[model samples]
Target: MSRSCPSRDAGLFPSEAEIARRLSQTPQEWAAKAKVLERDGLPRVDPLMGGRFWPAVRAYFLARYGLAGAEALAPDGPENLDAL
Candidate 1:
């Protein structure tokens, strides 16, 4: 799950539970985006993250929560930006 940042603020990143919650909030939104992605016909799957489920799931998370309006959650080049 979540790992506390070593910084003074020691904020928490999304845990598996948090990620699940964020992902669960708006399945319709994710389905819509996934449709667009499917139309575009990109790889839509990243082998690095254990097959096809992760990309769509991660996309849903990013669209729903990993972004703040327009900026990414960790915009200084997120470690897993592409996944989301």
Candidate 2:
């Protein structure tokens, strides 16, 4: 068998507060997600992993909850990262 995807790994982490600021979410909400990630063994704050994580999270919410759900999380949408 052969694998074509890169191995999943993470990097140095930031505080939830820092992530909250970067993503523009309330610290309370960040803290809650952080807790869930911790409980579920999800990596939410690793700097390197975070780059991979946040985008995937954004796509998920956009697909599941729609842009309106991400309004607070990503007010700028594709413009957030200049994808637009």
Work out the TM-score per prediction.
Answer: 0.25, 0.33
Give the best candidate by lDDT: 2
Q: Give the Å error, residue 26, model 2.
A: 3.0
User: Candidate 1, after superposition: displacement of residue 64 in Å?
Assistant: 17
| lDDT (Cα) of model 1 | 0.44
lDDT of each: 0.44, 0.50
Off by over 4 Å in 1: 1-25, 42-84
Per-residue lDDT of model 1, residues 1-84, tens digit only:
234223411223323333334557444564465567656542344445322354455555456564624643555653876787
Quote the positional error of residue 81 for candidate 1 in Å: 32
lDDT of 2 at 17: 50
